[model samples]
Target chain A: MAGENALNFQMIEAAAGRLAGHVRETPLLNSPFIDAIAGRRVWVKAECLQHTGSFKFRGGWSAVSALEGAGGVLAYSSGNHAQGVAAAARAHGREAVIVMPEDAPAVKIANTRAYGAEVVLYDRATGDREAIGAELAEARGLTLIRPYDEPLVIAGQGTCGLEIARQAAEAGVTGGDVIVCCGGGGLTSGIALALERTAPGFRVRPAEPEGFDDVARSLASGMIQKNNALGGSICDAIVTPQPGELTFPIMQRLCGPGVAVSDEEALRAVAQAFLRLKIVVEPGGAVALASALFQGDAIEGEDVVVVVSGGNVDAGVFAEAIRTYGDAA
Target chain B: MAGENALNFQMIEAAAGRLAGHVRETPLLNSPFIDAIAGRRVWVKAECLQHTGSFKFRGGWSAVSALEGAGGVLAYSSGNHAQGVAAAARAHGREAVIVMPEDAPAVKIANTRAYGAEVVLYDRATGDREAIGAELAEARGLTLIRPYDEPLVIAGQGTCGLEIARQAAEAGVTGGDVIVCCGGGGLTSGIALALERTAPGFRVRPAEPEGFDDVARSLASGMIQKNNALGGSICDAIVTPQPGELTFPIMQRLCGPGVAVSDEEALRAVAQAFLRLKIVVEPGGAVALASALFQGDAIEGEDVVVVVSGGNVDAGVFAEAIRTYGDAA
Candidate 1:
């Protein structure tokens, strides 16, 4: 366990060094409105503005860079992570093969292609992308860069937490609760390590979307738990059914209590961020803010840091989401 | 002429002092994609993220501050400027009375009210807002804050240009063509002064909406001009019939050749800014970018600055605009 912890921290540091300047140091915005509503001073870490519009770039780039001279990389994702891997591969001047579900938004597929990635489509219900991805990797001799399960990828994802800690320190928010939207515990695990290393007293919290509360249940059970019926949350980016093996232990050890919020709350938070801050945040990116607003009592009077994780929603989807839940004003 | 020039400059300086910290120093983003299309280095001064979501805030705040201790302020605007005055008045702890056309989008009216202003509605065809505003001001002893005609307001608007110049200087854009979306020339005049003072070699240009090219014709004729029909452009914020008396002379002295772009181009520019930079820009705010993309050959090889002046579009309008012209993504 001690050796594993040391390795995790070392990997995160290495990932940070490797991915520097390739991704944006997304703004950490001070929100008076959210603070008023939550009864806490809230600072939002806007990773939605990250390159390729998600925090996945950190892990994607980290994973690809670790392969060093690996000829090509492969990934299976329906959303932001796919774009992240594609963009990261392009940045490193390597070919990327992405296996996306057929029902993926046309914009996402086009964006992946625009980044010079070859996209292979499969039916969402009938196909196993992991199996297909594995086959393709073996055939092409390309390294498979899993979206979240790998240690290198988790370490890369932790750079966001490192950034949050750094930004929070600058804003005098040391030792506060840092809430991140969690899907497979990849981002949560990474953030946990960052908080533990940089700000030891700070509490790292994972916010899971309602109906897909695997992380929350896993933390309570002291072991990873699967949600068999994982309905689509508005936070599609973080709607994984189970936690990653490597990420789960780190999250269990370092993270604090988990919070859950409804899809409506997430949509409202996205609208608020867009209208008030003039930012375009996807539903998934607004999960942290949703947690702050809906689960305010959990973070009462504690200076809170909510990570806005990505902004890659299609225009049509965004319009529908806003119409469904946005405040009239 | 010299006295008028001195007055304009002084008002701008005073407005800058008065409105400091109340407004954002919105980012001036360098657009690689736009530059590639235009064959020029295109930099966008994103004022769309300004307080109240438009450059109108500068003028609104400046005008209200000039009224010093006035109990209430009154203004007539269709949207962005109305919200600007309302919000600015609230910021200064004064009551605001906005005379808006009833035909204005519900969102704009709600936004103005959200800023704590009293909204007085009048019919666009049957009721004259100017007459209504004057009567209200006279009855209540309220100060009348004109949208753009006043020297103080122009000076306040000029601060946006001042910021653009300061930001451009910091970014090492020493000399270039600075393009502003033109309405009544308030923003253009203000920016021209800022460029002349800070970046002497920079040429300031104004971009007018197609079919509403009064500023372009005015520059050519050395006098203010008006268009008979003015509803063709998506740049609603800059569809003014003629340049203000105080603003036209400044624009004439400092502005270069004017350009115009279609409504489709303006709408597309707004979508591009949102996708690329994650900034919400209104149609008028995107005029300069539209001009750059559509009229690329005009500024070939030159470093160009396009001022994205506002971002207060209604959700309905934004949805329609994107559906019609946001095919670029």
Candidate 2:
């Protein structure tokens, strides 16, 4: 609770080196259509295309691979990180125990199991998953991996920003805004730190779902904030009650006051992505693009980088996303 | 009507250079899970992520850019070519008039209109779209662009193979099998020509939907063949009655015996793609992947490159594909 995000540029570079053969160097995509919608040039780092269908794989792999003990790893996540840990652990022939919420998508739970992890579901509304995870890790002598607060986890996610730095250099850009979907500030803080060292002129703007905008509220008030509710959003991939202790301070230092997007706007972004970008994006993943398209006046930068964070959602949800808002095409 | 696929590798390289900054360098993806299922390394060139959500964009841009008189362009397509022509013509500030089947996906018609093309729908069961297109082209003084037989079109589609060659070199693979979805063999023939010149060790194998396996039948016999029926398969995008006049020759010379997948297998591949690859692949575009997964004994390659040619489908169709086959994840 006391320490800064402490991840430096060198650590992130080392993580990149560590993850060279293990993780995907996800592509950067741009469309004139997306640019027109935002009224400016916008680039999208398509982490939705990453393994485990999210950028969470980077952190999960970084943490799992660095585990020196033979006991393997234990973690808690709604879905994306669950699959990430399971997949990374599988790659290394290590064991993974994922404590997931019962309300998480069936596809997510199934994917985590298919990746060869032992999964335990808990009632997210009534049970404390973190406490359950700690008990299991202690009982089994397994190393517990926090989703965003862990130093190695933060370092791992920063590798994405490092790749962005190199990719942006290739694209002849020294500066811009990186709009990242936020839950607990892990990816945003890590990316901001990475940019501060390597890409100097780039800034981070966290995008959040409307009611669960704790990070955005925290950024504006200069204090930790909490959402009044948690489970109503369609953006299930990212719906934290508050920012992580380790991530909040760094976000305070590096990111602007974030923007929040409505569920309707996120669905619209999902449809636009499917229509024009030809990719599948979940509600949480589309929030950044939603902010970029709908909150243009509030954000800064002529050239913006919107991170499409994941593409894992239920069939009915995706259908609604496409059928309801597809006419926007 | 009886010429060969006269596109040389140099022509493809020229098209690539010509279309630089205009066309996207689509990413190549591979999944270990997919590899395990196929019992080999299957590299997927994600042309679904390409502009207009298909490889058709390449040919459209290539032919449109080479237009000398600039009377605008006219084409007859089921759907993809309509979008390709619309997108390319819009980019070049030229008019595009597309004769599409009236039964094509509503999304396809919407996308074509979004790109500013004038669409004329014809009944596939009763009318001759080619004749309608030709008549309109002559009447409106528009240049008629054939789907696959046009030399420039074939050369343009070959750019995908060109990029694959460079990407394969970077990945240190000298040769493999290139599995391509075939309607009239535009993309398949173009890639065959490109690979023949650049990576001679790689063999081409065309994949088609079961009921519409004209190309596969044509490859088996020593002459052009036609499907007994048209427009029954779920793969509405690739339902050509027969192989193209120009494309068939190149495919016959360069490719091995082609494989065909049932509509069920194609749906499974689409679901698998969504679950594992986190990409949206339409039914026709998924045939190559379906063949690779289900007909592995027929294909010849230690390393396989499956061209996921397109990702344009109705929301309901995609939702059904996901709900039905996504359980494999």
Candidate 3:
């Protein structure tokens, strides 16, 4: 499948202008405990605090607001992107249809519906959500918003990198690795492109879960790769089968070497964030943080900036993480 | 003992200037679900994300920075204040000794010590902490930084209020109740003084946990009132014996009627914060949020603001809160 055209900083600036009042500028947090564990200065960009509990909202708002005479929008996701697109569509006074598997968490479905999105549930084993989404969009005149392999979406995610560039400078961090939890590489590539122009001294590193380190393997081999297995890891948020067609090229051009951490490390990072940083972070969202703290030898420099991309985990999972790793973390 | 002299907004402004680089300007958050529950617009000031995981950092920095060639500092707190003062003191390259009860949580003690402070453990059943703190301060020639009764501390906490006024106005919220989790009334009175000058349209309201509703009772009686029992509720962070002498007068003159909520309500608020806002809120820190969501009738106007003052909680407590109230919230 083909992807959208390349993005530039100007597009990100335009997206920023469009998203000024609509998107939140999430805080950058650090704890001495986190720094001590990482053996360096560790700053966490709390994107989990962003609207819809993820950085996906930036892309969602950017795409929805840029629409011309929009009828509505359609998206297929069982996680952050669904709520993000729904909320953005509702805020723009346009309808949104979200296609999700029937087996997805009930809370996620309810949250998406709460944002005024029309949720179309399909059987994950027998039905294709993309097909359902496309049919619904065609019938309703709804624009299909791809999760990551889209230009405006990448530009929206780039706004986060812009903030990091400025915030790191403000915090006296002129040079560091900006670690991002990678799924389809939208956030990772967008940040790389943003930092390429704004903070060239800083580099972007894509961090993935251990068994799903396709981005890491792809970066090392200088070619895109795919994950063999998909559904076992607890870090489901960043477990895409492969990198995005649009984002991979940008990442290859701009990002540093990729990093990966175990699911246990991700869960431990979730516990530490809850204990020391006083924020809710899901296993997938904590992967970047895990790489920053546990895989410190893989990264260079005295300072590291990690983006916690989202925080929408089931209560049982969160409970298990905290109970199992809270003390040790 | 008599309290320190009354404070003014200028004092808070001076504290802000001193704390420009030392303290974090915490974010203000809101969720549509929260607003739906309240039947109005509700914004939460996430002081839990502040340095030391509480707004106490502001006052700590203010007190520590205002010192003139100080020898060192001494403080008494079993929770947030201990870590806050320790961190502020460490940032200033000054020695600090924190006096805590032996029965206090080991994690709190370890966190305080981790901030480079000397820990002095006293027997809660037999030892007079005040006498021990005074003696140690006198012997070591260290200045005693009071938790809330001191003028500089109140001025420090008021910095949070200054930010709130500016942020609320930016959010198009001109008039509303600014609810606070009250303990010694330091944070409540400090915000009242600040908003009195910067945002007169906004009113401060103290929210206390049930059975520890000294501030609410005191506000009703127009005098200082003490809680019948001190150590029972899960909301231990804001469970003060009584309102401060310095703070009561300010709150009486500037604050609106007080509000109170039960422990279950506070725990539920914590769960809701974790789910919707993706921020951690301990039971004590969540009372104001509980009041805003569950006791909306006591508040006025379409827009209401609540401060989640701190997020230093035990894993067991937090896990229990999420397990019991996560789905319902």
Candidate 4:
């Protein structure tokens, strides 16, 4: 059931019911700053304010809650997914252990532990976190919850798209372009499914960091593509090597060719959000907004909806972003 | 009607009906960081993301929509109230003329004009803006929209408290204490009326800046209290000299003795909000949060709701806050 290939509208609907009151229905922000950049109106789905500071929590809760027994959860992630799993596990009264990279941001690590998750750090250069997570899961009788590939996780992520469609309708928008921050493509694929069923005319696209434009390249080439290297971009949370095996098929079916933004552009998007939207968005989270702002010419829409994926950023890094891009004011 | 002595629940309910589709129903945020500070649950009503970046728009729209025919609207404000009035007037297809201090944040002045309001700048030190507003209103045959003193304005601000009670009830908080950032007491007085009507037993308190705590002192002394200085603090949004005669009576009757926080404390609260809540809050907007965090022992109730009043701050000031108080992370 976890490795299932397809996530349907029914499963997503059920997930929404399960997560009805558990997760926050983050606001759909309309900022003039983003509108000016696009030369058109822009709607922002502020997923940054979601519990544990990311959209990953939706999937985390969905997966952990569906686990068969009281075996608890074992997950591997750089930061956001780790916090999601940890927070969900704590809420469900299940034990959690996260296999995180040794160099994950100090804030994310602290936040993960604050949810009562035991941390097992692995060296990013020398160790395989997935292997460590699998071994830990097997040794401790824990269910291994994949960050994105699982059908339950994908269904959980689809709930955000449901919210997007509802909020757009409430704001009197019939259809427009939708941008999703992409790493392993879980969020993109999930949103694609939800929008397909709900707001059928609304199209979806992936936005990725320059060095880690795996999803964009894959979408263009009609096949899987791997990033050249990790740790090359400032958007550390989304530094996945490649798109997820399960998520890629769904993306190819429903999404368009995507846009890639530089780290500098993402930081500018982050600063713009602070100045105009008054929301704190992390680097990975800002990529979709970066694409909307910097790649405005390529984006075709009357109203662009950019999903700001998370807000779990290092304070020093966020401060520097404000200092660098905030000089214009 | 403009300088009415009292506003009631029925008026606020009618204002809510008028404001239903015009304004953003800003979210009530639950944050663990704030919860830890008070050793209890904390819910923040983020009015900072409201149209024109403050709760002032509620009053602005409420007032302009109820005005007499063909005359347009005139208002005096530092920034938030100006933008609100301008935006409300623009939406209602009425001309807006604003009397603002020349040294107001560049963003505010620009936003006001962006909404098609005529900008008339005055020196805060040497000029009387109310007189300027009055002159412009009489010359243009426009209805003057007082920032906080009017009954309609107070009713508009009351909508925020109405939202708070509704949102808190949805979150399963039966009863709690509410801390509102006070300027001329419009928001506090309005909220006092709403909570009294909708969510009885929830006590409300005013939180103000140290030197400019006119509402706080007034509540304590059971009489009007004036600030010794008008511009010593960085909170430019809530620098009213004294409580409004119309609003002060409502505050004194329904609110507890207020708590005042220093400029330094307000800045810390602003930074804390950024790091934890991922929301940009102006110094004036964060004073309620400041009181909740610093005056922990004094604050009663298992649940506390703090209203973050506005987010219309200059980018440079927000950047400085991140640098100054974000050192821990």
Q: lDDT tens string, model 2, A1-329? A: 22673567777887888898778888777777788889988888889888888999999998888778578789888788888889999998898999998977787787788889999899977999888988988888888888898888888998888888887777777787889999888899888889889888998889999989999999999999999997899987789989989899889988877999999999999988887787888999999999998889987878888889898877677877787876535
**For model 1, what is the alpha-carbon lDDT of residue B314?**
63
For residues A27-51, what per-residue lDDT tens digits would candidate 1 score against the true structure? 6775344566677887888777677
Judged by TM-score relative to the true structure, which candidate is superior, 2 or 4?
A: 4
Pairs clashing in candidate 3? none
TM-score of each: 0.84, 0.91, 0.98, 0.97
* Model 1 alpha-carbon miss at residue B320, Å: 2.2
Model 3 lDDT tens row, B48-147: 9999899999999999998998589999999899999999999999999999999999999999999999999999999999999999998999999989
lDDT tens string, model 3, A183-271?
A: 99989988888889999999899999988999999998989899999999999988998998899989988888989899899998999
Model 4 reaches what TM-score against the true structure? 0.97
What TM-score quantifies how close candidate 3 is to the native fold?
Answer: 0.98
Candidate 3 recovers a fraction of native contacts equal to 0.76
Lowest summed lDDT across 10 adjacent residues in model 4 chain A is found at A1-10
Q: Order the candidate numbers by TM-score, best to worst.
A: 3, 4, 2, 1
Query: What is candidate 4's lDDT per residue for B1-329, written digit by digit as tens?
Result: 53544467899999999999888999998767678876889899999988777899999999998887777888888678888999899988999999888997776788888889999999988999878888888888988888888999999999998999899999999687899999998898899899998998799999998888888888888889899988878886888989998988888889987988988889988888887788889999999998888888878889999999998776677778877885434
Docking class of 2: medium
lDDT by residue (B1-329, candidate 2, tens digit) is: 32562467788888888788778788787777788888988888899988888999999999999889768899887688888878999999999998888987676777788789998999988999878988898899998888888988998999999998888777677787789999999999999999998888888899999878889888888799999998689987888889988888888889988888999999999987887787889999999999888889987768888999998877778878887777654
Worst 10 residues of 2 chain A by lDDT: A1-10
Q: Weakest 10 consecutive residues, lDDT, candidate 2 chain B? A: B1-10
**Residue ranges of candidate 2 with Cα displaced over 4 Å:** A67-71, A101-106, A120-132, A135-141, A166-176, A327-329, B1-5, B36-39, B69-71, B101-106, B120-141, B168-176, B301-303
User: What overall lDDT goes with each candidate model?
Assistant: 0.80, 0.86, 0.92, 0.87
Q: Scoring model 2 with DockQ, what do you get? A: 0.54
